[model samples]
Target: MKRLTSILLSLLIVGSSVLGGCKNKNTSEGKTPESSAATSSVAAPTDKEADIVVIGGGGAGMTAALQASQNGAKNVVIVEKMPQTGGNTVYATGGLNASETSVQKKLNVKDSNQSFIDETIAGGKKLNNPELVKTMVEGSAAAVDWINQIGGDLSELGRSGGMSVDRLHRPKGGAAVGPMIVKTLNENIEKENIPVLLNTTAKEIVLNDKNAIAGVKVADASGEYTIKCKAVVLAAGGFGANSDMVVKYAPNLKGFGTTNHKGATGDGIILAEKANAALVDMEKIQTHPTVEPSTSVMYTEGVRGDGGILVNKEGKRFINELETRDVVSAAILEQPEAISFLIFDQAVREKLSAIEKYINLKIIEEAETPEELAKKIGVDPAAFAETMKAYSQAAASGVDKDFGRKEMKSKLDKPKYYAGKCAPAIHHTMGGVKINTVCEVLKADNAAIPGFFAAGEVTGGVHGGNRIGGNAMADIIVFGRIAANSACKYVEANGGYTEPSIVLEEAETPAVPEVKGNFKDGEYTGKGKGNNGDIEVKVTVKDSSIVSIQVTKHSETPGIYENAEKNVINSIIKKQALKVDTVAGATNSSKGIMEAVNNALNQK
Candidate 1:
């Protein structure tokens, strides 16, 4: 298409020359068309224009992008496939685990780095990087602070299944923690004015010679384009959500279920492999003990932390409720049917709202007898009855002699009984591109890849075989910032070009409009109606930044919007790129509007 346009333009120039006076024939004449055209053309920009290019716009990507920009990377570009920036982290519960954090200090809870390290290593079965683990544990507090500074809230504290203290921090809005963190980071990212390209996927890393990083090959609405830069950070995140990758890397989970965002494929991993980056802990896959019964709704471990129980068909506690998630999941897997039940009384249910959201609490088939409940969930009635009797006895005594469950006695003896099926589900991949303490990607020979770097789940060896629930959130924010700081220092020391030298001339013609919207000046804005005509949006962009957006119409129902608007707006803000979050109730509208915005912005 671009070639076609150029061809037409050249033809027009020739026609004008014949009808009007050519510069050759009218050299003596003033202000000829050919002479005017020569003066109007400009040069294209070069790859040496920016110091660093951060790929992937998740929590890790944003952190790297923000830090790089602050550290003096005159120009920074964040490439994200989704319309928004937060990646899988936006879906997180924001419950982070860190010893000696400000929250831990305030609550007077005592913990040590050694203890944290010990638990982490043991939990991951000694497959973790001792040095990277040390860095994560020691630097976690500061990471928490960074997120707070970026506008995240850590006002509420809670506990998770693997923790020894109530040190897990929750956001102000409870379950909205992930969105809040993403929103906060987006605000900080925008303030730094880092360039973010939404709906853009990095196909491959651009190499200068044999190994040193140069730039990336990106594909967007206009098709493939090369973005040149001195350094690249791969924060594209983990491969838990990709079934194919899961089968290839961790075949043990072949038939098992998983809990991961759909986009959590191994794109970053594939690119790293192409670059010959080392992958660590590839076989260590973590599985959650409980998933939603009917579907894959991920229920946070906080439910067990607050006193939920894991019962088998027999309706009795089977394993230590406070054990590490890996242990609990393994125990469930070893059960007779490879299935377990999560049971809690009504009072416990009211306290932990996660149960309802992740399960069909209302449609529960109530039973007066444990046998009946077991029968409903397709379990052995006699075995279930015996198990329930034992559990009640344990509850009465306030002790779990069989499983050593903490908070052992929260009596399951009520008039109404409930049972939900649960099995081990792979949660996260512990393997990714290898990086050093400075967050630089290590080459196959163990040398730093000069200008190449990686962070977050995309960078491996931190958690080894297993990532503690809260540690992931902290790692991305902390290490993301670390990578940024390092990239800037490298650029400054190497004396890379400060101003972008991109040459736009003689490019194949400018691409045609694959999508439609409005573009004027350096700003682009668009308004669109959703399929149901329930949600209408006005997205405004300025100077390559999404400064403001107005959701003029909301046809969305309440409660479901919890993950929609905030996620979209936050991505736009953080990436400073116009992108929309996945539509909640109105998916078509979501894609349409976001594509429209990208269409308008990509105009040459």
Candidate 2:
């Protein structure tokens, strides 16, 4: 019977691989696969245990795991459903917001935590939880220092919407802060040898008879399993990407494009609900003012904070570009077809390095003259020219006449003008599972759920109704660390993490398949689909054996693709086969590269 079971499992594996291949082919042609076909090929563990289990491997989850480890938790594990760990943090272009930071002090920019709290409350329309916001603000400076100490670059300070000072810290070149922070966190996690289970979903948060967190029920490629633990941190992000959830909370937001990654589907919220945790502010969804409607790519608020202006189809400025996101988004929605254009000159582009990505994505329309750029974007050329002339005058005079804009940093006289068609898109969800100042998950009566903690976008009350541009980063780092610390304390008070009592039956390991065929003795080029777009590779065969594989072109995320490319290519060359296992967190890139190699070998 055991032998029969092994054979059946092997057949199932082969069947899944075939289905995955078909899915990849469809994905290459720009068709997203249904959820059923997106499972990974890696086998799930039958018996797993941890002292602390963190759901989601995005910014908050990773930070919680790392801090738990640092706080002396012996066994800490992170489970992420996505092929990569960044989550929506990968899409964040703004910087980290913190007041009275060393970065701000070094730059001679004055800011106060009280001021930060006040602005955050005003942005949230006074719906924020005062205690949670106060805790976040008080810890903001240390969070900035912590990120810097963890090898992240945040030396440059800039302003963002709803900020009273230059408290937003990013890289020196004004680059997108999300990728940089993700890269830093990933590098540190690797250095610490932390275990992050990719392609693993937390199906349920198991509790003990005492109503405390006892373990987590998780599912991966092989099967469902239980991870016994003393504590669980819910860092899985918001439901901005889940259209049903979004429309359920805010009915008016239906059919709106979202700037969130596909993984922000409120998994943690569901898990918390099952645990009987309180939910708060579920209807407070905020739409960003400048997202490319077709691609759902957000043009960072830093663009407008630097000098970019938003204009209607008639080429007239309607509102202050640096207004809070909710206000700006509402203004944009009132425009023709609910669309507006983000217009900027070459000088503004030079000051912000994040714009290079927009250029690379082919989303930004550029021309040497304002009239030419306007015509390309389907706007009136004369009106746009006059608008640019007036905006230049405002910049020269250090004043905005029409919109009362406060920060006019540059004149619009530089050549090579640019414009991108943008519209308001669902960006941030301010409501989630409720938590206290210490990051403890709360019951409806305001009592802490024993052994349960939450942080980042998974928790509500940090941002009342609307999230500030850079506050999300600060919220994740500060509260993620706090949640870990609280979980560690709880474990210690409960005599630390005890061994799991539940026993699970182990599944038979499948036998490895033999290499089927030899490759032609030459170089071949082939293409496959990656998480971002097409991935092309050049495969070199020598003596009818795979010798080398190189990724010639790809649009995958920077830090993520490198790991998949290196691991998959090296494994293919070493095994001399294409049936290698995909990288844990980078499944899509791994499969894409493997498919490209397989395509290369099949050439006539």
Candidate 3:
């Protein structure tokens, strides 16, 4: 009887293991698990397959996947390593730089492609590949139209630093542009039925024996598997978040905080390097001057573009706030303690919806008068009042006599002044794998790698040594579509699409271990680190079951925090457990909320 019982127990354990491995896959909203339907009408296999595999699910990768599908690729897949699709794009607060667009025409803003080209080349310090610059400028109008066609709003026109005209396009209310773009693209991806594999990482680009693209080796909770494909687009972002990579290339930026998403770790560059792709301008990195020193939150350049001032410890206006980011950051670094304060009035804040986020994060110091603001921020009150008076006069006269700043839009004389402490932090990495105008990844000999393409921050030469504000948006949209079009053409000319059929091996599941231990019945508060800072939550329990979870305080990004809070908190309450999945594109915030709940329950 004992022997028979042991055999039955062993059988039960094996069954449980198999069942655990077969748990539900983490997919984007509106995505289905039917692999056959997602890729093709063919029968499903143990492993995944697609006609085109995009390695990153950021703005660039999402755009490429959608464009490839529209260009006749039957099966398209987006692999994102993070819990969400929006990479660093969710953090962008700038506008899209474009010229000769309908928005520019309607707004009576005069702009030309040549002017844009010249400015871009100059901003890049002439280190940019001329061909790439021309291509981007030429396609700017079309990119703007494409965004509009896909239900994205870019009608509002503004100017960014280093621009000669008011050519930056954004949403109607001067809201942050990046999250809007990502949300629109995600909606379109769902509408087109493009399958996005969340929590999946591409391990390697599997090249066939003929030195052409074959498939991509990826890993998920289920272990390693190869997604069979003919062409791959490396739309993964840059290495701004990778301290080692940043220090390796630009050692002077050591210990600087980053404004990039955690996933911007140069995975695409590493992959391209392994594939023998050439790199360019790897040493050039850009730093933004207005990042919050403690939390690394980057204040939008629009703050200054719309009428904000940088004041040193002595309470004097320093550099021209409208200058290029590099120049402004350098000026800030030259100040005492390498820190400065961004001061603006309620009028400037009203013009920019992005400022509301800064207010919500509790980072912005509020005062009804200049002296009060200066005293609160530890600056000379008399000097600050004098600086404000001088700035208001300059704004009223449309002439910056002090710093020669040209675009003084407002006087900032309104009451309820706001200030935030800021310093220089690493922002964008301007170097990566080299690519041609058609978005084909090139080798060291300047020969195109067959069936390999790259776009966005992964491929350099577009920005040269320094990228202009707002051009990063144009670069991703223009080149992402170009990369997809080229990939589709290459696949059509080279044997067409083939259905994938590969055997996948069962591996241990990495799903958050199911929450264990009974909870004591009571309300508890906990905290966790979010994308920008800490997230605190109040948990209510009833009969040892979570009754509700409320976010009492958080410093997360605006749009992103809402999504994660709604989805993650509700899931935890519904399941009465903390094994809920993080929302796509809002992974950090979701994890932070979950961690807070866990801490609350465990009293850790």
The parts of candidate 3 lying over 4 Å away from their true place are 1-24, 27-46, 497-567, 570-604
Candidate achieving higher TM-score, 2 or 3: 2
Candidate 3, pairs of clashing residues: 84-584, 84-585, 85-585
Model 2, 1-604: lDDT tens digits are: 1110011111022111110111000011111122234644434345567788889878898888888777777477777776567788877887999998888888888889899999999988999999888998899899889888988889998789888688888888799898887877776665444556656789999989988999999876557788888889999999999999999999999999898888889989999998999999999999999999887879988888888898999988888888899999999888988899998889889989998878867889999998998889888999989999999999999888798888877787898898999999999999999998889999999888899999999888889988999999999999999999999999899778554232211222322222433767888999887766678999877777777787899877664566577657755775688878886546887898888888877876
**At residue 588, what lDDT does model 1 achieve?**
49
What does candidate 1's lDDT look like per residue over 1-604, in tens digits? Answer: 0100011111011111100111001111122233445564423222234568788878788778777766666477677665445667765763776777787787687877777777777776688888888887888778777777666677566666666666667764345356566666666665555555555678999887766777898765334667777788889999888887888877878876767666688899889889878877777777877875455656667666656677765455678877877888889878877778776555555655444544333434557777777888777788777776777687788787888665652566764666566777878788888898889888777888878888998877888766777778778877888888888877876775476332111212211222333334354444444332335455555544555555655432222242345444544544554654464332545554555455545656
Evaluate candidate 3 by giving its C-alpha RMSD to the native, one decimal. 8.5
lDDT of 3 by residue, 366-440 (tens): 999999999999999999999999999999998988899999887989999999999999999999999999999
Cα shift from native, residue 36, model 2 (Å) = 19
Each prediction's Cα RMSD?
12.2, 7.1, 8.5
* TM-scores, each model vs. reference: 0.73, 0.86, 0.84
lDDT of each: 0.64, 0.79, 0.80
TM-score of 1: 0.73
